[model samples]
Target: EKKDKKDKKEKKRSREENGAAPKCADEKPAKETRVEGAQAAGDVAARKAFLKEHRMTMEGNGVETFFPCYTFAEAKFPAQANEAIQNYAKPTPIQAVSWPVIRAGRDIIGVAETGSGKTMGFALPSLPHILGAKQKLPKVVVLAPTRELAMQTSVEYERLKVNQVCLYGGAPKGDQIKALRTNPDVVIATPGRLIDLCDSGLCDLSQVSYAVLDEADRMLDTGFEEPVRKILGMVNKKRQMLMFTATWPDSVERLASSFLRDPIKLTVGSTELTANVRVKQTVEMIQQYDKDKRLLALLKEYKVGDNSRVIIFVLYKKDAPKVEGLLKGRGYTVGALHGDSSQAMREATIAQFRKGEIPIMVATDVAARGLDIDDIEHVINYSMPLTIEDYIHRIGRTARAGKTGTAHSFFMHPADKNLGWHTAKVLRDAGQPVPPELEKYGPPAVKQVEKTCNISEMAPAPKITFDDSDSD
Candidate 1:
């Protein structure tokens, strides 16, 4: 009887294999879960677990991460990450969009206003790529427009445990060359000095697979087109490319077309420039002579003790020293930073500001961009910036790290009458009501006046300036 049962079971299995259900058996086959891999046992599982937990915190979709990626902390990155990197939050709007694209080894052209965390927008992803690649270590090159930008990038890049160096002018060339000797994984440089290093055969950029042109619009404005082109030609053609800028102009577009291949256009300006919502915008109108007094009054109201922070911006380098001197004399503990100051002084002043020893900084437009000082509670624009772009950068110092901030601008007598239309347009874009009080001093060239020039269907008409082309 047992022999007969065995024969019957074998016949049933054959039938199931032949596209039919077993005649007697009613259960399905059981499978075992394999939690190991070819390289590292359980690596895939651990990675999935880590990413599942971290992805949400890092990508809070603006609701969670309100400020820039001042710190890589919110990402809950691996504990092996350097400690200095843990104090700041996750990525900004532009950084979040660009990080994945860069990690995928794709080209990207990011349009974010200055002080919008554009530096780390590409740096974070590229750092890991260069550090983690199992293949030959590839170099990542970042080209910034000015010395200050190079230093800013250096500060963030150094926060990572990876090997990196900054090579730019204004600092001693010997020290820069010494840093380069380490065979760094990343290089932050200016277009001019980078070209010089390439010519000297001191920097081997042929193996550089990731190339970034930070502040692309500024590069074009400063006439670094030829130098930038030469640097781009040296890096690997099969590598990734990224360009970030505050404003997207024809020059930036042309450079993007030349450098990046089918680049992804990641922009926060869904409708217009006003979408740079990380900054707080305000206008304080007063008489020209009362500008100084009103600024003092605003400072008094803002109240920066040893804990709070302030960054005051002046239009000209001449005004930087003047304002700083006066503020210091008034027991405000202020310092002046401008292009005229030596690199050492600039760095020292920045250090003092960072240490909170100097609570207030009076700077010019040259100090406007590429600065990453954080937790600034107040941005007092003593005078309105000549360029709306400068205004954006100045105010961006505040409202960081999920913190509310104040940006006070003086639209004193001269500015209300003299400031350009674009400045007012920026205000309108911010959703802030630009009261007629801002235009208290006077109107532009032409004004409307009622006249009895029987025209259309009325007996009176207001004369308006109209070119033939302006007519619809």
Candidate 2:
């Protein structure tokens, strides 16, 4: 008995030196563990109180486990955290609240406007979960709605030295299959291609412990809900799930209930279709034919510079190339991105835009949701989006990382009148001026003019006889 006790003591000391969990028999006493847990609870309470004092509203069960961090220095792995902070300066509001919740190993639903640093909000917390794990299978799977977003998410993981594979359509699958053979630690992919890989036995999700649904709303909008649901079902049910979106529609709410287990919901601001407050919004009422000229004038005001990078969004895919040509002809370096653009072209365009080789990018809604580029000073809506949600996302391309930006929207009368009411409401909520034509469509006003004239008010005219003179 004496010899066994001595051996156990030495074993516990060795494990401590090696940074391993202590053996059950040598673990701390239950009462001591409980006391430490109580202290942690108290610390979280204090942090929540601080958030409340700052007017950051958060609500849900088990939210006390989440504590906001003012800087990356407060992170669990400060070295890794500092890498991101060095680029972003500090955490945004969403990142500040989300990091702790995700780090606490609880499911979370994060809703914030575009350009709020949501990518890092989920990425930072996932690092610790995946870093030391065996690379036989993916431990983290991030599903994005578009290829651009998936690629961007993968880049975030790469910056941290985390091994990752991005799988999406439009690109050749042979490379992706070869990447999967290496058994990466993370898989960033679109829903359709992920499902195809899983079905073909080229990938596995049974061991996936962390799953993130980025741009959840857009996923549903693009008819990816079925594939997303299927992928979720294949993953470990005991895993931690994180759902992030710019807007929370009924579809996304349903998705959360089905996949997430007792999620804590966090919203950075009012739960409505709203753009970042830092974006100065302007709505110009112009004729349809004059939109190109108006866009030229706006672009002239914001030339290529360190702080003058811009994204111009068109409503249709066909318009993207046309706009690109028009801008290039006007002596502006520009690139186009849309659904029809080949994967190689899209990648080259995005790379050029990121490096400021092309200071302006003309794109469709494909670039609206998850393309994260820094220092975008302006977002020009050459054509109004079909929905107010899309409009908010389009303008969100600017005003990112707490930096101020400008959004200029061309609202052609008659053509864009259908969206006038919703557009006016969004502008009003943001405290921006509503064009007179759009203001007429606002609440408490008539959206359409009723051209009515009563026949009873018409005056009678006397009949006159004319002489037949020059007919012959």
For TM-score, the strongest prediction is 2
lDDT (10s digit) by residue, model 1, range 1-472: 9999999989888888899876546676656433211212333333333323322112111111122222344333445455644564556666654554455455766776556677767776675657556543337899887777788888887776667888877777898788778778888898888788779988888778888888777776648888887888888878788788777654346545666564555555532444245566777666667877777777788787658788888887888888887777778988788878998999898888878988888888776666677678888888788756567767877775556677888875554456645556677777765757654433347655444211122222222122234333
Pairing residues by index, what is the TM-score of model 2?
0.82
Q: Lowest summed lDDT over 10 consecutive residues: which window, candidate 1? A: 56-65
- How far out, in Å, is residue 7 in model 2? 25
Model 2: per-residue Cα lDDT over 216-256, one tens digit each: 87876648878988999999888999989988865457545
Which candidate leads the pack in lDDT? 2
RMSD of every candidate to native, in Å, equals 13.5, 17.4
Q: Which ten residues in a row are the worst by lDDT in model 2?
A: 456-465
Q: Model 2 clash pairs? A: none
**Inter-residue clash pairs, candidate 1:** 71-88
